[model samples]
Target: MGSPCLKTVGAPSLEELRNSPAFPKSEDFMKGPIAVIECIEEIPCNPCETSCRKGAIVIGDPITNLPRIDFEKCIGCGICVAACPGLAIYIKDYTYSDEEARISFPYEYLPLPQKGDVVQLIGRTGEMVCSGTVIGMQNSRQNDRTTIVTVAYPKNFFDEVISMKRIKNKS
Candidate 1:
C-alpha cells in the first residue's frame, strides 16, 4: 500500500495576506481595531462567523466559503480570533499610539506571558521580526482553552508582527 501524503502546510505568505479581500486597508487600520483574516483555504468552517457578537463575519450558505468581514460592524473584540479553529484570525489596532501598534492572537500554550513581559515578535512565516511587549491578555471560559494575547510593537512593524514568542527563563 502506498503511504499517505504527509506534507504539512505552512502559514500564509505576505503576498497572500496583502492580496486577500479580507485584509483591511491602511485606512481600515486607522479606524480603531479590526480583524485580519489570514484564512485563505476554503475549508468547511464557520466558527468565526458565529462567534462575532457584532455580526461582522459572514459566510454564505456554503460552509466551505471563506469568511468575510464587514468592517463597518466589526468592533475588533478579538473573540473571533480565539474562535477560529484554524488559528487564522488576528486583531490589529494601529491607533494604539503614535509610535506603537497592538496585535492580538489566539495563544494555546503553557507558561503564558504576563503583562509587561517583553517578547519576540514573529511574522506569518514564523520568523522573528522584532521585539514586542505583552500589554494585555485575556482567558475566560467563553474562550475555551485558547488564550488571547495582545502585544505592542513599533507602529512601523504593525504589518510584519503577527505573533509573539515568550522569552524563556528570564532569570
Candidate 2:
C-alpha cells in the first residue's frame, strides 16, 4: 500500500515545515472528524503559521496551499481563531466529556452575547437543530482583535455546527 500521506514526525525541522508534504485527502479532515483550519483561502496568511505556540499548523513556501495543522501539538487554546480571515479556524475538543464535546469558533456579530447566553445553534448549512450555551468569550491582547466564542453543544451535533447565528423571535 502507498505510504500514509502524512505521518506524525516528532518536532519537524524548519525546512521540513517550510516544505509541503503530500497532504492527506481533504475529505479525511474536512467534515466528519473534528478539526481546525489555519486558513481557508491562499491569499496571504502567516498569522496561523507564526501564531501557533506549539508549531502545530504549517503554511509552506508558496503560502497559497491550505495549511496543515499538526493534531499532536494543538492545545485547543483557540488562538488561531483570531488569526483566520475566513473565520474557518476553530478549536474542536471532541473529548470534552465521555458524552459531550465543545466546538469553539469565531463570532463577529453585533451586541455580542456574553458567556452563559442561550443561543440557537445552527449547522454548517444554516439549519438550526439544538441549543448551545456560550461558555467563554475572549478578546484579549494575544487574540489581536477577533472575538473567540466557545460554545458547548450536544456531542451528536459536533459535526453539524460550523457557524451559528442568533435566533430571532416571531413577530
Candidate 3:
C-alpha cells in the first residue's frame, strides 16, 4: 500500500494574466476573417481564452474543447501566439483591406528574422506550400519564450499560412 500524492499544477490566475501582452484588453477583438487553431491537445490551458483579452474565446467549465474565438472583438493582434502552450493559437485577418490578408502565429527557432524577410510557409500538417514575408515579430518578457510572427500572404491562401520556416536552403 502507498500514499496518494496530490498533483501540482501552476496555472496562471485571472489577475496575473492581465499584464500579459498576448492578452488583448477588453471584449473587442475584431470583425472579419476567422482563425483556426489546429493544435488539439487537452491540457490545463486557458491561454487561448485569456489571450483575446476581449472575452472572445471561452473554454467554459471544462477548460478544453478549444476556445471559441469571437470575430467581432478580435483585433487580429495575434497575441494568442505567446499565450497558447501547445502553439495552437493564431490570427487570420482575411479582410486585410480586401485584397490581402495577414496571418500571425508563434515562432521559436534559430536566427530570428527581421521585417521584410521572406520565408517558407507551412500548413497544419507541417508541409511547405509557398513563401511569405515576416511582417512583424513581437518578443516581449510577457510572451515568455514564444515569439509572435506576423506573415502577409495572398487572400486566397489566407487559410494555408499558419506558420513559416527557414529550411536551411538544403543546397
Candidate 4:
C-alpha cells in the first residue's frame, strides 16, 4: 500500500498577505475592534459567515468565496474564531490600550493557559516574536470544543502575533 501524500504548508508572507483583499488596512485596524479573515484558500466553507450573529462576515454567492468582513458591523465577539474549522478567523481590538492590543485566536490543546498567565506570542510562521499575557479565555458549549484565547501584547507587535504558547517552568 502506498502512503498518503503530505503537503508542507508555510506561512504567508507579509507582502502576499498585504496584496490579498481580505487583509484589513491600517485604517481598518485602528478603528476599534474588527475581524481579520486569514483564510487564503478557496474552500467550500461558510461557518465563519454563519457563526457571526452580527451579520458582519459575508460569504456571498458561492461558499468557496473568501469571507468578507464588514468591520463596522463586527462586534469583536470572537465567536467566529472558534467556529472556523480552518482556524483562519481572528479578532483584534486595537482600542484595548494606547500601548497594547488584544488578539483572540482559536485554541484546541491541552494545558490551556489561564487569565494573567504569561505566554509566548508566536507569529504566523510559528516563530516566537514576543511575550504576552493571557487576558481572557472562552470555551462555552456554543463554541463546539474550540477554545478562544485572548492575549494582550504591545501594540507595536500586533501585526506579528497570531497565536500563543504556554510558558513552561524550568525544573
Candidate 5:
C-alpha cells in the first residue's frame, strides 16, 4: 500500500503530523486503544476536550489551537470520538490481537451495520483499503445522533484504515 504522507491525499501527511505537538508518538499508538485526533485545521473546536474525562485532550488559549492528546493519560474510552463535530477523532486499538486490530469512529449515517457484518474499510483519502467486521456500536441520547461504531480489521492496515464505507439503506 502507498503511504499517506502525500499532501494531496486529503489526510494529513506523515511529515505534517510529525511536526505537530498534538501528534501521538509512534510508540504510543500500540498501547491499547487511544483517541487519534486528526483535527488538522486550526478551527475553534474543543468538544473533544470537554468530553475527555482524563483530561488527556487540551486546547489552550486562542481556542482555535489544535487539541493535543497526552497518550499517557488517554484511556481511549471513545467519549471524544462522538464529541467531535468534524468527525476527526477516532479510537484505535493496535494491540487488539496478534493479527487483528480495531477502530472506532463516529458514524452518523442511518441503518447502522450490525455486529459481525463485514464492511469495506476506507483509507484516509476515501480509498478502499480493506475489509473489516463490525464488532460493536454505541448510540445514545448522550452522544446525540453520532453512532460510534467499532470494527475489527487486519493488523497490517493499522495506519491505512481510518474509516468504513457507509452503506445505503435497502429500500
Candidate 6:
C-alpha cells in the first residue's frame, strides 16, 4: 500500500487522483450524476462508505483503506458528498444540461453561497477557473454541517472545476 494521505496539506495531486478507480467513465459520467472520490492515500476514514445508502462506496477490511466507488451502484444522490470528513468526495453530473455540467462539493464555511448566486469556480489548486451558478445547496443534520453546493458550468470544464468560492455576501 502507499503512504498515508498526509502529504501536501491534504491536497491530492490531480494526476494521482485521476489514477483512482473512483473516477467514472465518460459514458457513465455523461449518463448522470456520480460520486468522484479523490481520496488518495490510505487513511483511517469511512464516512463515504457508511453514508452511501446504495452501497456504492465500500472501504472494506482495513478502516484505513481508501474508499472506492461502484459507479454501477452509485445513484449520484450526493449523500456522501457532505459525509466525507476529508472533503474528498464530489458529485459530477455531466448531463445536467445540453452545454453545462454540474459539480457538487462539500463546503464548510460561514455565509454559505445561496441558490442562484454566481460563484467563482476554483480548480484543484486554488486558482479560479470560471464562474458558476449555485444551482443547488444541501444542508441538514444528516450532513453534519457540511454543505453540499452544486454549481453548473460549461461541460468542457467538468475536469477543471472541482470546488468554488462565494464572491457575494450571504443573503
* Top lDDT model: 5
CA lDDT of each prediction against the hidden true structure: 0.85, 0.64, 0.63, 0.82, 0.87, 0.83
Segments of candidate 1 deviating more than 4 angstroms: 1-9, 166-171
Candidate 3, TM-score vs. the true structure? 0.71
The superposed Cα distance between candidate 4 and the true structure at residue 165, in angstroms, equals: 2.0
Model 4, span 28-120: residue lDDT tens: 988877888887777899988888999988887888897787777888788888888888878888889989999999888877888999899
Which residue pairs in model 4 clash with each other? none
How many clashing residue pairs appear in each of the predictions shown? 0, 0, 8, 0, 0, 0
TM-score order of candidates, top first: 5, 1, 4, 6, 2, 3
**Tens-place lDDT digits, model 6, residues 1-171:** 354333754566666776776766678786698999887777788888888899999899899877778888889898888888778888999888899999989998878887998899998767789998999888878888888898899887888798996455547
Q: Local error of candidate 6 at 125, Å? A: 1.0
Tell how far residue 90 is off in model 5, in angstroms. Answer: 0.3
Kindly give the stretch of ten consecutive residues in candidate 4 with the minimal lDDT sum: 1-10
lDDT of 2 by residue, 1-171 (tens): 332222333222223323534222335333332345623335766677777788877877887766887765666677767776667667776667666667777877766778999778775445686788888888888776677777877888755666568645446
Query: Relative to the unseen true structure, what is the C-alpha lDDT of residue 89 in candidate 4, on a scale of 0 to 100?
Result: 79
State how far residue 77 of model 6 sits from its true place (Å): 0.8
TM-score of each: 0.90, 0.72, 0.71, 0.88, 0.91, 0.88
* Tens digit per residue, CA lDDT, model 3, 38-127: 543355678677667777667777875545555566655566667777776677776666667777777888577788998888764556
Misplaced by over 4 Å in model 2 are: 1-35, 38-41, 167-171
Candidate 6 residue 53 C-alpha distance from true site, Å: 1.0
Which TM-score value belongs to model 1?
A: 0.90
User: How much is 160 displaced in model 5, in angstroms?
Assistant: 0.7
